[model samples]
Target: MAYSFPEEVLEHVFSFLRSDRDRNAVSLVCWSWYEIERWCRRRVFIGNCYAVSPEIVIRRFPKVRAVEMKGKPHFADFNLVPEGWGGYVQPWIRAMAASYPSLEEIRLKRMVVTDESLDLIARSFKHFKVLVLSSCEGFTTDGLASIAANCSNDSVARLRFSRTSNNVSTTKLLNLREIDLRESEVEDLSGHWLSHFPHNCTSLVSLNMSCLGSEVNFPALERLVGRCPNLRTLQLNRAVPLEKLPNLLHRAPQLVEFGTGAYSAEIRPDIYSNVAEAFSVCKQLRGLSGFWDVVPAYLPAMYSACAGITSLDLIYAAIQSPDLVKIISLCPHLQCLWVLDYIEDAGLEALAASCKDLQELRVFPSDPFEAEDNVALTEQGLVSVSEGCPKLQSVLYFCRQMSNAALITIARNRPEMVRFRLCIIEPQAPDYLTLEPLDTGFGAIVENCKELRRLSMSGLLTDRVFEYIGKHAKKLEMLSIAFAGDSDMGLHHVLSGCDSLRKLEIRDCPFGDKALLANAAKLETMRSLWMSSCLVSYGACKLLAQKMPRLNVEVIDERGHPNSRPENCPVEKLYIYRTVAGRRVDMPDFIWTMDKNAGSPEVL
Candidate 1:
C-alpha cells in the first residue's frame, strides 16, 4: 500500500499517538515515517542512560522536551550494585546542555546527580518546570537551594529532595503543587519549612515526607491542609503522633492515597474512635500504606476506610493472622495487597473469601532464616487463593514448601496471570509431596499462562522447563532464574527461542560462557542480560565483547580483584547491553569494559 500523506501531515498525525511503543512501531514502516516520528517526538524515555549517546538523541529527536532516564541497573535497588558504580549524571547533563536548550522536565532514577549537575540544569533551561530524582545520591542541600532559587516560575510545580535546606528563607517556590522529601537524611527540620508555601497557594496535591524525624506543629499542618483543599496524597513520618492523625485526616477527607503516621502509639478509646471517625470521612481513599510498628489494638480504627481501598501495604506491620483477617475482611475492593508472611494460610483463606477482586498479592518473609515449622504459609495458601480469586493476575509468594499440584492448580485457575513469582525461602526446594523436580509444575505455568509477561522460577529444575518457557511463553519479556537450571542447554533453550524476551536475569546457575556466547545474536535485541555467580569466564566474555561491538559487555568484580588477570579469572558477574554509546567513561574501577574498541567508537 502506498502512503498518501506528505511528510508534515504524517508527522502531525503521528504526534497524536503519545505512547513511545506506538511511535517506535510507526517509525519502522519506512524512512519517511521514521524521520517524521523522530521529529514529532516531544517526550523520550531512555531505560538505560548509556543506551544512546546524548549527541545521537539530539540529532535524531530535536523536539524532545521531556526526558525520563534510568541509570544503574534495577538490581542497584537491592544494594547488589556497589557504591561509586557509575550511573553519573554529568556526561548526560553536559550533552543536554548543548543540545536541548528547550528541555522543560527531567526525571532521573538511581543516578548520581551532583550539585554541579543540578546547577547546570537550573541555569541551562529557560522554561524548566520539573526535576524528579528517585533513589539518587551525591547532591547536598545546596543543590536543592539552587533549584529553589533559580527555578521559581509557577511552571516549576514539583520538587524532590532528601536533605533540609536552611537558607530557603526567601525561596519563592511559586505555585508549588507537590513536595516529596522521602527517606531523607535530615532527622529534624523543625517543621518550619511548611511555612514556605505562599499564603494564597492551595495547589498542593501531594506531600510526602514520611521520613521526617522531628515533631511537627499540628496547627501549622492543619492550616496547610485547610489551604490546600486539592491535597490528595499525604505521607507523614512517625513524628506525627496518633492523636494528631485524626485532625490531619479530617482536614484531608478527600484524600485518595494516605500514608498513616506511626501506628504504634498507645491511645485512649476516645482517641482511637477519633482516629476511626477521621478515617470514616475519607470517602475517596483507594491506597493506604505506612503502618510502622502496627499495634493490633489500633487496627480496628482503619476499618471504615478499608472498604474503598484497592492497594494496602502492610509489609512493615507484623500483625498476625487474626488482625490481618479483620482488615482483609473490610477490604473487599482490594486489587493489590502487600503483607508480611505472618499472615498465614488462614489469613490467605480469609483474603480469598473477601477479596474476590484481588489481582496482585505479595507476601514477604519476615524472617528468612526461620525454621521450617516457623514459616507462615505453604502450598495450601497458594492453592486456596488460586481457587478463590479467579481474576488474580500477579503474585510474589514467599513460602517454606510448595507442591506441583498447587502450582498446576494455580496455572489452570488463573491462566491470565501476567506475573508469577514463587520463591521458596529455602533455595532449590522440590515438590513437598513428590520430592521430585519442579520442572513439570513450572512447565504448566508457561503452557497455561499464555499472556505471562514476567516469571521468576525457583525449585529444582532441569533444561526441560527452559524448553517449555522458550517454546510456550511467547509473551514473556522478563525471566528471573535462580539456583535451578541444569546445564548450558537450559540457558540455550530459552535464548534460542522466546523471541519477545527483553531481560534475562540468572544467578547461582550452572550456565557458563558457552551459554552466554550461544545467545550472541539474542543479546542485541534484549534490553539487558545480568548473570551473577555463574561459571562465566573472562576469556569468553572478552570473546563475546569482541564479537558484538554494539553490545557493552561488562564484568563487575564485586570481590576486589583489581590485580587479578582477566584471562585467568572467572567472570563472577556479567552485564551486557546493546548501546549507541560504545563504552561509558563513568564506569567504576571494578567494572571492566571488555569491548574490542574499548576506548573508540565512531560518533553517531
Candidate 2:
C-alpha cells in the first residue's frame, strides 16, 4: 500500500508552483495529481503558436485564465521573414472565446493580429484585464479603441455600486488594468484612442505606446494620465514634445517607470527649471528610457531622478562618450543598460567603475552599414565590465573586432553568464590581434560558463568551435550561427549532442543533406530549425517531410516553383518545426508546403 496525500493538501501544494516546467512535471505524477493540476492551473505559455492548436490547449488546461503565445522566428525582427507569412491570431482567439470566457490576460509576441481579432477579444472575455503585444504587427489604433471602449461596461459599475450602497462614494469600478505595447509595430490611424476610456475608469496601471510612429492627441493623453491614479508605468512615443512632459509628470508622480518622449527642446530658463522641478518629485522612478532626438542641454534636467534608476535604455540616443560618461556617473544603481556603440570603450570603462550591481549590458552599432571602424568600441569594453561587475550574467556586445585573450579573461571573471551574444559587425571577421578563427575564444565561453543557455557566435569560426560547443554546452537551448562552419560536420556535432537544444538558426553556412538526414530523429525533439542561404537541397527536404510525420518541413523558394529546379538543386530557404495543426492554410504563393503522404512532391 502507498501513502497518498489528501486532495486538499495536494491542491494547496500545486498552487505554489509557478514555472510551467515545474507544473507540467507535477501533472505527470499520477492520475489524481493530473486532474488536480489541470483544474488549478491558471496560466499557459505557448512558445510557438503553430506547434499546438488552441483546441488542444483548452482541452489540456480547461481552467486557464491567462495565455502567452509567440509566433514567427527570432530572425523575423531583422527582416528575414517575408510579409504576410501566416502567424495570424484569429483562429486562436475564436477558439478561446468559446472555451475560456473568464480569461484575463493575453500576451502575444511576433504575431499578426488584425482589427477584427481585437474586436472579438474585447467582446468575448468579460473579465479581460491585461493585453501585452511585444514585437507584434498588423494592428492599428482603431483596434486599440475597441479595447478601451468595450473592456469595461456600465453594468459592472452599477453592480459594484449596488453591492456597496453605504460606501458608494469611495468605491470605484475599473475593469481593465494594463495595456503593454512595447516594441510593437502599430499603425497610427488616428490619435483619438485615448479618449475612448470612460470617465469613471481608473483601472489602468501600466500603459506603453512607445513604438507608435505618429503623434497622439496631447489633451486627451494628459486627461487620461490625470485620472488613472494607480498608473505606475507609462511610456510615450517620440511624437510627444518635451515642453508637455512637465505637466504629465506632475499628474503621475507615482510612476515607477517612465520613457521620456522627445527630449529635445529650445534652451529656455523657464522650461529647464520646470523640467528639473518635475523630475525632482518622482522619488519612486526606477526604470527610464526613450530619449529620442535627445539634446545635450536637456540631459541635466533629469539628473536628480537618475540616482534610483536600475534599468536605463539609451539605444536611440546618439550621444558621444563625454556626455555618456557624465550620465553614467550619476546612475550608481544601474543594473541593466542598453546603449549605442557611440559610447566607445571609455564610456563602458566608466560604467564598469561605477555600477557594481550591473547584471546585463547590450551595445548596438550606431551605423551597421558603415565600412570604416568609426567607433572605438572593442572587446576591451566587455572585458572591463566583466572585471568590474562581479554580478554580470548576460551580455550582447556588437563591435568591429574581438580577441581570444579578452574572451578567456571575461569567461574566467564571470563564470555565471547565462546568455553571451557577441556580433562582430563585419561578417566572418577574424580576431584582430592574431587574425585567426575565433574558435578558441568561443570555446572558452562554453567550457567556462556552465550555465550558458543562449549563444550567438561571430568572428570567424569553424568545425572546431562546434565540437567545443557540442561537448561542453550541455544546457544550451538556443544557438544562432551565420557565415561560419566548414561543412556538414559542424551541424552534425550539434545535432548529435545538445539534448536540451530547442531552437537553431543558421545562415550562409555549408550544412546540407548528409548531416540533416543522419540525425533526422533529433528534429522530433526540437521546437524549430531555420536555415537560409545554405546548402540544403529540395530532395533532402522532401525526404525529411516524408520520414517525419509530425514535422512540417516548409521550403521558401521565391525564385520559381519547386518542380522547376532539379531535385538536387539547393533550396533557397528551409523552415522545419513540429506541429499538431497539420499544415497552415494561410501560406502565400511563394511558400512550398511538403506533404507527408504524397508519393510525389506537391506544393500546398
Predicted model with the maximum lDDT: 2
lDDT for residue 236 in candidate 1, whole number 0-100:
82
lDDT of 2 at 589: 87
Pairing residues by index, what is the TM-score of model 1?
0.88
- For each candidate in turn, the TM-score is 0.88, 0.96
In candidate 1, position 566 carries an lDDT of 52
Summing lDDT over every window of 10 consecutive residues in candidate 1, give the lowest-scoring window: 166-175
Per-model RMSD to reference: 4.8, 4.1
Model 2 lDDT tens row, 387-504: 9998899999999999999999999999999999999999998889999999999999999999999999997999999999999999999999999999999999999888889999
Off by over 4 Å in 2: 1-3, 151-174, 599-604
lDDT of 1 by residue, 1-604 (tens): 3278888778778878888888899999988788778888989999898788888888889988888888888767656677888888888889887888788778888888888997787667766655667777777655654554553335543444436754323222434455555543442436655654445656668777675667766676787788788899898877777778888888888999999877867668888889889989999999998888788789888888888999998886788888999899999899999998888999999999999999999999998887656645888888888899988999999888988888899999999999999888888888989999898999999999999999998888888899989889989999999898888999998998798998888888988878778789899999998888888887888788778888998888867542356564667678888898778777666787874654222121
| Candidate-wise lDDT, in order | 0.81, 0.89
